[model samples]
Target: METLRLQTFMVFMLSSCGFVLSFQINHLLYTQSNPTAPQTLDRNDASSILNSNFDSSLPVKFIIHGYRESGNSEWALKMKDELLVHAPMNVIVVDWQDGSSGWYFTCSANTAQVGEDTHLLISHLQTQTGLSLNNVHLIGFSLGAQVAGNTGKRNPSIARISGLDPAGPDFSGKGASDRLDPTDAQFVDVLHTDGEPLWQGGFGYYEPCGHVDFYPNGGTRQPGCGLVGEICHHMRAPAYYTESINSDCPFTAYPCTLGQESCSTCNGNCGFMGFHADKSQANEVFYVETNSESPYCRG
Candidate 1:
């Protein structure tokens, strides 16, 4: 029964991609100097990047939104604000809603181009301002997470790539070249909030695809999401991440297998799950518990 449902969903998603439409991507820049109003960045024009309020000395962070979302997405904006508040840095929101809203497959196919475009923009920044790619971090949600992976594939030196419940459809069972993988960045941290099978209405990838995969609440049907369903569980990835930016509470996670109840002895083997996740811990899986409402972290 589950297999039948999953096959049906896959057919629908694949067919949806057949109806193609052109899409244009935009990069919106926000710096401490200009928080609210974003300056449009043009990868082709060096002056647009170097002449603007962009600070080359600061670290560069890109927030890539998922399907049906724009650069002005509330979550993206909120994250940008929180990041800026936490520290002075360059936050670029990758807006590709024009291409994302058409179909799931279309949006999935477009992630490659988005990644290519982002890579070009980063190269331009490097050439123009001597920006260090090591200081670059890509934070993406759903399909946007795949976009980050594509970008990282083009430039493997990226410091970090955070996959916030990376979209599972069309990406599952694919090779490293096809979807987000551990090799995409120097340090890849994945947060899996919705890992149930597609037949079960899960929208997030179930398998661990990063160097450090953090599965909160067993990575499926997050607590307090009750009647809200999969979307709620999927969006929790970003909500938790955004709060981790400056929250006094810590999202501390303990090392454990996927369904392990407790760590026999963590012995300092634990790592902070969200913004403060330790990059040095490689190929580690951790479990975290969170509250149902805002201020989700339990410390």
Candidate 2:
């Protein structure tokens, strides 16, 4: 608990002290429709894949894994498979394990460079393949959420950004410009499944940082998640998202009044939360419930 408290306080302190963390990140692109081996690229090599197996005409999706995770994390791998299985997309997975797997504070600070690098990759893809930035979608988890938000800010033409439980400790109360936010993209959707305040052992930002924010089962404690030592709630955001990729039953949600966590009543205005999420049909502060097991969607 004390450590978590310091995470918040030290963020301010470090920023005030002008401490900067800089590093390069690995960017891997995989085409669900193409079925070739993964294309590994970085800012310096974004053009390498432009010649190999990339199709510029397809909609591009970038999945960024968060703190301590690599390109092969279960969530990233699963989400990657799901996207491929459901749609024909140019899925690019951003791997920042070199920057992300380290002291928490260092990884937190490295997000700035990670975002910058992503912007560079997108710009190169646009130049080489005529890939429209407007068709770009970025999905990030934990601190990767901040990276995506920063990328969207740097490249405003990005179509959408989905933050699966953005990291909270260093970013919980920071302004939109400093963390994941709605204005980062044309459509920003956030799934808050572990938004409990930091002192309470939560690691995901609680504020509604997206144009449409979905809270499943209060977005704090999930229905069947073991509270102690299991951040199952935080992990739920990506699992549900992965499932939404191909599930016949869509996860839908309703609006929650202020000071409310979860609302049981489903309304006509309900919006689908995951892969079926349509920015045009979105609402703020949406609440919904899901089953504890797979096929969690209530439809």
Most lDDT-accurate candidate: 1
- The total number of steric clashes, by the backbone 3 Å criterion, in model 2 comes to 0
User: What are the clashing pairs of model 2?
Assistant: none
Question: Can you write out model 1's per-residue Cα lDDT over 1-299, one digit (the tens) per residue?
Answer: 65665666565455543344667889999998999999989988777887798887898999999987899889999999999999999999999987777678778888999999999999988888889988999999999999999999999998999999999988998988999999999999999998887767788997999999998888887888863233789999999999998998889888889866545346678888888888877888998989999989987
Global Cα lDDT for candidate 2: 0.80
lDDT of 2 at 120: 87
Candidate 1 segments whose C-alpha is farther than 4 A from its true place: 1-18, 227-229, 261-265
Clashing pairs in 1: none
Quantify all predictions' global Cα lDDT against the true fold. 0.88, 0.80
Model 2 C-alpha lDDT per residue in residues 1-299, reported as the tens digit of each score: 56655565445323432233655477777886454468776557645765656677887888998876798898898898888887788888898887886667778878888898899888888876788878899999999888999899898778999999999888977787899887788999999888877766677888888888888887887878876224677899999999988888878787786348567666667788887787865547888789988879886
Each candidate structure's TM-score, on Cα atoms with residue i matched to residue i, is 0.93, 0.89
The lowest-lDDT stretch of 10 consecutive residues in candidate 2 is 11-20
